[model samples]
Target: MIIERKQYKLLEKIIFEKLVIQAPFKIPNPMPDEACFLYMLEGQINYKTENQNVSVPQNESVLLKCGNYFSQIKNDKSATLHQIIIVHFHPKILKSIYSSDLPEIFKKPSFIDDKIDLSHINNDFLIQKYIENLMFYFDNPTLVNDDILILKFKEIILLLCQTKNASTIQQILSQLFSPTSFTFKEIIENNLYSNFSLVEFANLANLSLSSFKREFKKNYSDTPANYIRNKKLEKSTELLALSEERITDIAFDCGFKNLANFSHLFNAKYNCSPSLYRLNLKDK
Candidate 1:
């Protein structure tokens, strides 16, 4: 399935919101700037990350860091997912909380260069409580003060850190000061061509091809080639929707080798060829 990139209007102030989205059968590429916490409320969600592909069954929660390349493949049947997505204004968000005299856990950076393990925290009751608090904040977004909300967000992090299976706070903290060595963002931005290979991608991530493939499957539930194709197809669809470009031009721009291949993949993904898909949208 192809992963579509959804564009959102940026919010000037701190925002807290809950999202309920039915899994649109196709997989979606990662949003570059947003940091998300996804809780599986009633069904299954398959997520592929740079290093792993994991499925969050009902009642499980997952944390996704910013700039991590990922895609989601949902089950065929309807599955309910409640997500708390917070887009921080970079250093400002961290600076506000770091200056406070909160616990050491809160002082640590919330955004890290590497992915931290929150999977070991097995207390379902506590997880549910956090999810509830998240929903409450979403319900009363206006009443929620940025400072207090930030603190509560800190508390949530600290609580998750306290979970038995969570990595030691120190280990997680080390990531803040560590050098930002990996360049998944560069890979996505520079190599939009269909010819890019998995071996090359693995080399860029500094992992063996086997290990990279394994982790990629674990995080995204799709192989590297499939993920890239999905992203390209997503871009093609967006262009088709908003631009006056010709079909052959769109195909080339999206890195497809030819018009026929683009139509084949687009039809397979959206259940309609590119021309018909655009026509249906125009009708609407």
Candidate 2:
């Protein structure tokens, strides 16, 4: 399956893309440098981030804060195709929009969350119409006007602001204008429990791989891989001792992908397998 997109670069910092992804494939964390409003148009896909793993169904929408993430679309041998419309706005574009002569509502700060689910908003029809209008411009690029595109962007923001999820929409705008740089610790805390790779973590921290390693050593006094592995194993042990959750669930929740791997790592770290460790705690 291929990842296809018809992208329209309306401004230096604004882009409209219609993405079509065939099933049975995974798009390894294509982290954008800007925040995005993602509207699901067709089938479902499993969207995974450092902080979330969600199934975004068709017609639902999500506002993704600018950060590291990856997505997977599996067919399960079915014939369903996944499609999405994305409005990606760079920080500069956000700044331009925020600085314009708009009302006080537009001046409100856009908050940044790892993920903001917009499916609960009952304004899907209205938002879909706006997308259709944008498509019209996309289809007729010759007729595209910068002033009109800016207005369209503002219109969508205003429409979202009027929805029930107005607070989140406002935060999205507010956060866009004020992107906080995550510290090494903050990044680690946010993603330690996720199934993200070292490279993905580097991207999340906005650092090169070597720089991330250097910073990790400086802050944690341990290699990134070792620190994360130990932390996950510790978490797994705590969960095993404290909760009745299955070992497999504990493994997954602790960021380990498989039970065998988790058990091996756990045994190596604690001198006992996960199930045996749980039994030991129970016996005590």
Candidate 3:
């Protein structure tokens, strides 16, 4: 089934909370501004993405990028899972905390590497306690202090890094910084329909525009504009399949200037016009 992209909530720019999820639930694909860390408190979770599938058991944590597609299948019918403390923050929040020395891992999107498992990390008890405290604060929002909350978050990440392989840290950082270099699967799943200039995107990564463009091309073998346009076309196809919206409206909503330009790009990218694509989808 084709899924429509939902506008992300820009909640507080930096916010932390606890998540308790039941089994057999699917998490819809996230928007670019939302990222999360899942630390399993009890039971087992089978997580699937386009490129990989991972089974996370109790006391294990998985870091998910905003662009990644993930769904969970519960292993036990009676099992209950607690995602300890989830910290959702924008890139700007990290910049304010780390300044220019922001760790490279935070720059790019990555699944925490296999070599770096949180289950074996020391201070698991401490981490659990930290989460408990945060949850308490969440329950009592009136007494929450931003400074203390941010400090606790920094401590949690620092400790996780200390327990992980050094190389994994570097790779994660690189991925966070260069979103344009994201894997082809990620490119398709991320729903990059919003039009953004190279300069604007580079600024998000704290990189000079020219340097960002150079690195982007080197990694993805496509210019940012072309990549974004192609992604929009892909989304337009899904919208055509699932919605009764007129092709021209869908084109403009997806960032095309006009129907002619949208049809031309769609044909170039998919070798079919929008109406024909929808017709084929209906036939299927």
Best by lDDT: 2
Q: Which tens-of-lDDT digit does each residue in 229-263 have in candidate 1?
A: 99999998899899987787677667676689899
Model 3: per-residue Cα lDDT at residue 144: 59
For candidate 2, give the lDDT of residue 45: 61
Instruction: Indicate whether candidate 1 or candidate 3 has the larger TM-score.
Output: 1
Give the Cα-based TM-score of candidate 3 against the true structure: 0.50
Q: Candidate 1: where is the Cα deviation over 4 Å?
A: 1-15, 25-35, 78-91, 100-123, 168-185, 189-284
TM-score of each: 0.51, 0.63, 0.50
Which one wins by lDDT: 1 or 3? Answer: 3
What tens-digit string does per-residue lDDT give for candidate 2 at 1-284?
A: 55676766654544677778766444433333456677778877656654566676777777665544444554454356788777776767766666656444435454444454222343377888888787787678788777877788778777777677777666554554555566668778867767778888888778899999999999999999999999999888789988997777678667776779898898888898888888988889
Lowest-scoring 10 consecutive residues by lDDT in candidate 3?
Answer: 1-10
Pairwise lDDT winner, candidates 2 and 3: 2
lDDT of 3 by residue, 140-178 (tens): 766656676677768766755665543454443344444
Model 2 misplaced stretches (Cα beyond 4 Å): 10-14, 21-34, 44-56, 64-81, 109-120, 135-151, 194-196, 232-284
The candidate scoring highest on TM-score is 2
Error of 2 at 1 (Å): 8.1
